[model samples]
Target: MKLLSLLVAVALGERTLRPRGRNWVLGVGEQGPAARPPARLPAPTLSAPAVSAFADPAGALLAGLRRLLRGDPTPRCEMSRFVPLPAPASWARSLSPEASCPRALDGEWLMVSVSGRDLSLSSLLRKPAELQPEPVLITMATAVLTVLTHTPAPRIRLGQDAVLDLSFAYAPPTPEPAASLAPGPPPFGLEWRRQHLGKGHLLLAATPGLHGQVPAAQEGAVAFATWDDEPWGPWTGNGTFWLPAVRPFQEGTYLATVHLPYLQGQVALQLTVHKPPDVSLTPAPLVWATPGEAPPELLCLVSHFYPPEGLEVEWELQGGPEDGFQKATGEKWLSALHHHSDGSVSLSAHFRAAPVTTKHHGARYACRVRHQSLPTSGRRASVTVEVAGLSGPSLEDGVGLFLSAFLLLGLIRVLSGLVTDCDPQEKVTASTPPTF
Candidate 1:
């Protein structure tokens, strides 16, 4: 109990305090509404001049003015940041305008970023809110995307989504007492990136804006958390994603990467996808075969499997009530592999079963399969076999005897008729009378 409590306490950081009702503002020239510079915003909104979230607000404004000199729509620029409204000066400090962008915890936090920045723009403009310049292109280079591992880690289907939770509420930034008069850096999260998933990184957890969000909330004090004393920089968090519906061709190995500026630590992460097969047994072929003929055989059809290799099928037999199932080795042989258009594979297996016998009546035969995608015990199916061995000579054997006797009698009668024909044809006495 103590250990669990301690761990929780450590993970939770300082709970940020915020001013209620008012939203943060972004703009050029701090005056009128912009004149009121609060330490933090409850939930900030853009005023007018605060539309831009660039490091060089004044310079960006100057560039916008030049574009307006020629055309209303400014020259195209990339979306560099989605820094929360009323962004603290610390967010811009030591951070390059081109290096990365500020993203929210929730993957669906688009509305939050827009609303906050717009509120700040209104405030910064002070007068009638005018001249709103938005980013033309947003690169995913610094965008945090969804991170996915192999299914069956928790187990999911190929087309099923692997979703995650990465959401949180945080306090706005506050101006520091230092000479720079710059507000502290906004909270940031740790994220993971992959090779094929575009330039987006995977959101991890907690904010490191001022103090670590988790540690702050858990310990009830962000100031005294372990981050303060730790050699690595502040904590970061709020990341999530779900992969697009995957297909069979998409199954393979992948590499994942995460960037940590402070620690320079890298994780060797990889993912592999596998699809299991469906197995079935057929005993109908052996059901009607004569005992003296060919050996009884069972067929095991394996289909819809992946990688198209390392598949094996075995047959087992249980003869009589007292006998246990035994492997019918040397009798199992696999047929050629057949590839499916859907990127799956199939195989046929023939197992020569034991000869049918009266003692083996009511026996059971089973087909077991082994494959990379299957569990340790693998998959199997079975069917009961009933065999009453050949009893007496068949009807064909009796018919053979009857035909033999009839053929012998017919041969004797034909020989006697031949003898009578030879005597009559000679007629020696009739020849003598004619001579006298």
Candidate 2:
């Protein structure tokens, strides 16, 4: 009975102490339950002192931690587990020699020490711990450090092995595309009038229906391909072109094109070379005069299809062989001068002295007309002036003769002894006779 009771008690105790169904009980020699993994603790928050100590190597690590934290959706405690501490050497090098040790205690304050100098937890912990490693934090911290380090601040200690490793988040800058040239609306349907200037230049003037906006720059070289032309411009503000001289040997109409860079368009112009016209000058007959006779009235008439605005008329007397002659002026003369409106300029003047004696009679007088527009063209006329007998003398001529005679007599008296001379008187003989 006693044995039965004891056996029953042992069985009951085993059942009570063992785990529920499917549980395996290990004897003393059997292996124990697999060791439970060590409970993970949250990463320690670096105190101001520790942060200063680790600054040299910890900056990169802190930045990484910040990145990881920013990416993590978890709360602070969970995030700390994912962000592990950086390599000790990298952290140590980042820290200054005087900021070598830092500690966090009671989750409220950070104690810092450098070169045996103590810095209070409150003083170093002015900024929130979460702000560390952020861009703004580093900027602010550097500024604060600059101000603080100048004063009697704690010193940091660093070993030769310490190094700071930093990697910046950077991206290449994007490039912008160049601006396109903009040309405004072109004129509607209209035939353009083309006028030829010197060389390869053709002036395209706007006709009745044609209109054009002036280009920004006026001068430039044009480039044209068979199919298309584009103006690659460093255009000038003056719309002028200087081109090589064209040859007239070719018989066909030459097709030419120009690319206006500023206007961003191609222009077509045509040139036709032809022979020049025959040009000649012929003068009309002239009236004749004599010495002491009335001056011959001179008139010249020129005929041409186109007369330029800047025409100048000039006359020269035809003396034998000698080219010297006086330029005729509009001053008053012995005879009235007249220039008729029929394109003929005339002059009438009395000849005080005959230009040609009977010996050089029928000499030619030439008149020339010049202008700017007609460079290769001019008008010339010639007339003959002959000496003939004079008409009756006038009162003016008689008075002139009387004055001439009076002057001649006065000159003879002053220059010669004929008028002032007296006969030599005989010497008085009274003194000589008394002596005798």
Candidate 3:
């Protein structure tokens, strides 16, 4: 009795077991579709299972059972292609069951022709119907770039250290019809190109941030610097590059290109280099001296500028017009300017002018600075020589001294006359004559 129960349990377990599209048996053994041998003589032929029948599990099981009871029919799978839209009329008309389809392109039409002996369209339609292709599936790919800087215009001072940052990021390609399906990471690279400035116009240094890689910088010419990123599958991340410094060049607009893998993408970067002049005005003696003394010198200092070849300095009496302003000439305005090794300039101007009076007081002697780097208004520095007050005796003190001097002279003369006349008037009869 126990053995009988064990056999029944085994049977139940076998019946419950189900495998994916594989052959099975009930209380017996079964052969897979691939392992069956062909029949040599005439025999009863069974109908094959329809591909569409798989959509209904119960119906597929019933059909599979019926086919197994009789002689099994050969199963076959077939694929068909439809010509994409915009194709020639002949091409569309020529589509056949054996024709192969090319890979579908984005924004292009594609036809999927599905048919097989096992999958009966007529049965599903409940009547004979024409075959048609389904909608096309398009795949989209993109690459995005962003630039960040420490300065407003990403400006770099000539011969001075500066750094610019660039960030490159991208996402994986998305397959249409099934947007959730993302492609595995594709290989990517980076190349830098210059548009405006010629090579060697300025020295440039490139360094990649963490997660950034450059595989071919030296292989390419000076105009292009190449980089490659380590593969990170279908994930969104970014890399950065830094431009530490640049040598002096003509002040103008410059364009840098980033050769990206994006289709129909515009990826060019821009920067500006300016050499605005820094000016200062000074007088040898900041204040005016007495009229008898020699005139003081006016000095102007121009510093921290670039491309000094065409630099010019003009002197103005206050804020005067350019025509009214005098350009620094010969010895009157001596320039001790020299171009520095670092592509910068430093210079001084000297001018001699008379002492400041009330007319010239508070009037600004301006040094207008001009250069190719400066804007239309230009840059300027000014100095004004002020009048100095006299430090001497006042009118009240002079009058007191004169009066004392005159009084001393008169007393001395009177004393001298009295001493000389004393002996001649020595007669004693003066007192008796007075009494009579």
Candidate 4:
């Protein structure tokens, strides 16, 4: 194996190693009625599975032909050519993983010509009923490719370290005597850009082996670091880049462009940093509003979350005194909001008003907050309804009543005693004043 690898590498003139489709549709192709495979004993068969992975039915149909054909098969059909065609300009960043990007894609046509026996079209079946396969799957072809899914691409995630792999399907362009990015000629470059990020001193010379260094910092043959794109940094014609420690500022559209010695195109991915809400829940245990006058309210506070999308607040009712919570409906009040001086915003959802019946003795109304950050059940807080039944007044009310009665009785007694003492003694008061 090592000898074989070495020989292959030497044949390709590689100092060391080399290496590495969705919207995925498949179509089957059949030859015209006039076309037919010549019965010259047997011929080499093409492997249909090798050309496309999704052509499973074509693979099964070709397998039967391979078994019947005894001896070395002569090659009949060959894969002409396939190229990675870029999406139309109007599609823009259509391939971006962001949900906002339109998923509708313009179709690309694939022309297939098969040389094999053609069966007469079934006249009984209508045009709509006739079979129409996708992506040109060939069943009776003599030569075909044993198709398999290609090497997996990079898994992009925000705030996580991952390899930004830019591998070529074909053997890369011939290695020059010049320096490479790594042991082999793998591309090593990292660039981040957005207007809000402001400017940094990041620079990359057009020459190879620059590796994210400022143009001024590099040595001989810097070539003055000329490029049209202003935000470029640390990139050359390498096959891969080690993207490390993704930060919040890096959240935005990330476009990976390739300008090889002979080719140029771009692909993009989206990165959005999600700030999970602080989710402070304040459950008011008492009735949320004045009894018999206003609607009862169950309030939920969702605070400090990023990308302030709309959230859902649900109120659940306890089925019975001892029963678990179930879905309860109420007229939704407007959401309450809280804002911080630092510019953080939070919203509160209130479940108030709307009554079906007032028999809510010890019934619990739970307020559940559903946001992009929370789980399926969401962040919840519950409050039990203390139905205003035959209970006495509160302690403060009872004490106030006692104090008012005592003060009133004392004032009445003092006024009556003064009035009773002054009336009959008025006649004796005049003679006593003259003697004095």
Better of 3 and 4 by TM-score: 4
Which parts of model 2 have CA positions greater than 4 angstroms off?
A: 1-263, 266-283, 304-307, 320-360, 374-377, 389-436
> Candidate 2 or 4, higher lDDT?
4
Under the 3 Å rule for N, CA and C atoms, how many clashes does model 1 have?
Answer: 44
lDDT of each: 0.38, 0.26, 0.38, 0.36
Instruction: Give the per-residue lDDT digits (tens) of candidate 3, residues 376-404.
Output: 67898876545444333335556878988
Clashes of each: 44, 27, 3, 30
Model 1 alpha-carbon miss at residue 109, Å? 32
Q: What digit string (tens of lDDT, one per residue) describes model 2 on residues 105-194?
A: 111222111110111000111122333453331211100000001111211111111111111111101122213433322111111123
- Tens-digit lDDT string for candidate 1 (1-436): 0110000000011111122222112221233222333223222232332222212112212222232223322111111122223212232223223234333221211111111211101001111112324652211111121111212122334444443222211111112233443343233333333333344332222334434322112111111111222122112223333444445543322222212221111122233445688988886533543444434577888888876778777777776445887765436778888988767788988887645555555667778888877888889888766553344444565687788889988998999899877895477755765544
For all predicted structures, in order, the TM-scores are 0.41, 0.23, 0.40, 0.41
